[model samples]
Target: MPAPERIPSRGLTDTELLTLLAEGRLTVLGQVRGASNAVLHCTVAYEGEERTCVYKPVAGEQPLWDFPDGTLAQREVAAYEVSEATGWGLVPPTVLRDGPYGQGMCQLWIETPGGGTEPSLLALVESEEPGEGWKAVGFAEVGEGRTALLVHADDPRLRRLAVLDAVINNGDRKGGHLLPAPGGRLYGIDHGVTFNADDKLRTLLWGWAGEPLTSEAVEALGLLAAELAPGAALATRLAELITRAEVEALRGRVAGLRTAGRHPEPSGAWPAIPWPPV
Candidate 1:
């Protein structure tokens, strides 16, 4: 069944969500196993196929007052593309479509496998147990085939994500946002406050006081640097999504880090990043 031609801004409520599903309005096959804010995940039949999708049906103009930026709804799509462009398809694939709920968006649902829980990169490396390290990720539900984000300690993927987070100045890299897929594939989400030029390093992942930078790691940084040179297409594309100021500020930080050859360390006295990101 085709979606209604136009879904209102306020998006779908649970009742309508089910109604549409029953009538083959959009073929929602199963119940919502997990949800947060205005998002829900359910199994559905679409185009003669059984699939599950995460539905984000935002109410119109009722933007997340807490974060208060309407542009994020627009940016999430672009960010997915950016990660794909950067040779990191670890991110989720998305399908922006009308919802059975509010102004709906359908993203391909990625099932968290029963392969243990998401590892906490912070805990994996923090043998020092120095201070409050990135807390242990919840795996109870995950390993039991329930829904939850995952991450791990000692994972090279988290290291790469940390670098990418710093580069993007992602302000929302909470423990829960780092979803680890079935077989050790890690993915980051909730990038609403990203692309800021300022220092937005508010995450819980680091080891040995964030320690000295490794040579191989620096090589990856160098690789990214070389890829983002002036007139570089990737950098140019990023410039369009975020303000030129934000992009330039990001470039400066990357350059400085490359020059210094270091993993980022906390400098200011700001408290740790909040978990679950509202």
Candidate 2:
């Protein structure tokens, strides 16, 4: 069945956006390249106002031996639910819905700073020199037998995102997933490959390893743990999306993070950073 013909206005608040996305008419604008799945840049309109959103359709998902098929879209929505329940707001508003193609995950789009008149809030660039104000995360082999310094903004938002990734057990936190919005706000996207039962966290934000977690970060972890308690809202919602064992694993991660009280150190069992860092 197609989505409903009428949707609420685009004047939706963050909370309201979720409801609209679940039932709104989705129009695909174009394809977002470089994604493993079929990711479409889409516009969801209702009552003459429109908003941009990224839609990841499940039917287009490539089979993975590690992750279950047709469940990535649900995981994306689950990530957003966790972020909101913990009061972190690190992820943009996301929801599982029936789109133009089929069932998929739709996330509210955020404008990249400096797209026009706005000054650039964040920029991802590579330079030969690893200058100050920039933190060298890893080395990338640029073509022509040259090594390039891959650096990221040394911003507090990036730090918070690292903590969020740890708690979620994100397996693929690529540099391209970090979007810097206005006012130093950082939004983490592409959460389709997260919350696995095993330790699959691969990311680029290893600069804070062994550092003590901030007091606020600790509190957020506590909140997430509480939200996953038996009969908790997030637990109930997650059960509908993922398996029971996965939810238990998520709880375990929260407990582990709380016990450590510091940023995670790479276990060395797997690659610390993902391939193609940026």
Candidate 3:
């Protein structure tokens, strides 16, 4: 099936978009292919305003050994909460509400530049070391027994996303999850596997592993630490989306980052990078 036409939500304020997604009339346009769970491409309208969105219903979630069943939709919303707290807006506006299929996550759709020719944020180069404007993310097998170094851009937006992923314990951060919207804004999606109480962070943004946290990251972490304190507003909101233990783990991660003052290093207990990295 042909893809639905992209509709930009640039004019709506974050508050307005969230309200529209939560209360608007949702019309499913098509199903997004390649998602492990059902992801519907839909348009949400309210009070004569409309915008494109992606909806993932709880009933369509596949059971994961690590994650609790029927909770992926909530996790997606939790990830959005954490993203918004960071002030980076790395995640598009997302909300959880009743949909045609059931309760699900509805997120504002982002429109990328035409022709899939948006400048590359990730690449595989023959050189062992990455050139300027790029950060090496280790190596990958290309085909025919050849290997190439995998790298992502040295962009600050990606760097911020890395920090946010750390806070959420994101277990998947594949290249396809990075959405480069118009006006240079970058957003990350498909956070259903996130916010686990365990150390399951897997991503291609490990380029800055062990580096000193950027001043901006430190500042964001500081604010997050306060907001995640027991009974804080953000904490209260998150408790509704995630388990209490998971919420506590999130607090520990932010505190740990502030104390370490550096990006997290892989613990070696699990896979450091997700499969099919791009």
Candidate 4:
């Protein structure tokens, strides 16, 4: 079991990688194969610092008949506290502590530079018009009976990760959870099916579906609707990681995207894309 050594932490600082992923000394360094849970690939350490992360564990979660048992490691630390309340770090510092397979969700391991050959915010284009800086995300198949289009990179870091998967209702934004790090910095990771008080928004970033919400995503959803009101501090740390009806349905989806300034359109009741959509 030996392949874990990437350890960059981009020279540490989001409060020293969330205090070395919440008081380090973890150590697994293995198991992250195709992950449906139990991810591990550890490292952590403390005082005498160390890095690499990604823990997962709440006894290796896997229940999901509609997300309840073991709460998917507190919805992956409430999607890293709503991606650090949308100032847009795009989720990487996660924390929910106590590791070595006990309480779960650690995080902070974002390396990804040339190893992945770069240039891919996802693509496929045989050509049904995902031209100029691409966006499409529809036709896929790609086998004997063909079908191609399926685009993505219109950039602004994937439109601020489709406005943080529409304020964390993200159900499974695959495309291998979009991490592109180093300089062009993009992160996103497996938010354990996110803050679901329903309307589970599955995604491959829908390429700004309805369009219009970027005055820097309406000023980061108006400062994430004043830090999700009701006793802020990000609604008291997302009420210790999700559920008060999924943090009031994540503050009613940032007040329904600040009363629909746009960029939504796909509620034909879920499944708007995400099934090996890479």
Top TM-score prediction, candidate number: 3
lDDT by residue (tens digit), candidate 3, 1-278: 11112234657777888999999999999999888899999999999899999999998999999997339999999999987777777788899999999999999988777623245789889998999999999989989999999988998878999999999999999988888777777788899998889999999899999999999889888888888988888999998999988998999999899999999999999999998675
Can you give the lDDT of residue 36 in candidate 3? 88
Using TM-score as the yardstick, the better of models 2 and 4 is 2
Clashing pairs in 4: 25-45
Q: How far in Å is the alpha carbon of 234 misplaced in model 4?
A: 22
lDDT of 3: 0.88
State the displacement of the C-alpha of residue 43, model 3, in Å, after optimal TM-score superposition. 0.4
Most lDDT-accurate candidate? 3
Each candidate structure's TM-score, on Cα atoms with residue i matched to residue i, is 0.63, 0.87, 0.95, 0.33
Q: Taking the tens digit of each residue's C-alpha lDDT, what string does model 1 give over 1-278?
A: 11112212135543343333333234455445334345565665633444456555555224544344334544454455455544555456543456566445455555565533354443323232323434333322334565443224655567667676766666676766676665556777766566655566676554323456555557656666765676887677665555677657767877877777666776575444545432
Give a tens-digit lDDT track for model 2, residues 1-278: 11112223235676567766666678888998887799999988766557888999898888888897338999898888888776768888889888888888999887766542222223334676547666556677768987776666566667778888887788888767877666556688988888888888888887678888888788888888888999998899999887888899999988988998888988888788887655
- Displacement of residue 267 (Cα, Å) in model 2 is 1.4
Measured by TM-score, how close is model 1 to the native structure?
A: 0.63
Q: After superposition, how far is residue 19 of candidate 2 from its true place, in Å?
A: 2.0
Q: What's the lDDT for all of these models?
A: 0.54, 0.77, 0.88, 0.78
CA error at residue 96 for candidate 1, angstroms? 5.8
Q: Which stretches of candidate 1 lie over 4 Å from their true place?
A: 1-37, 42-51, 57-70, 94-106, 114-152, 208-210, 226-231, 276-278
Task: Report the CA-based lDDT of candidate 1 relative to the real structure.
Answer: 0.54
lDDT of 3 at 261: 97
Question: What's the distance in Å from true for residue 251, model 2?
Answer: 0.6
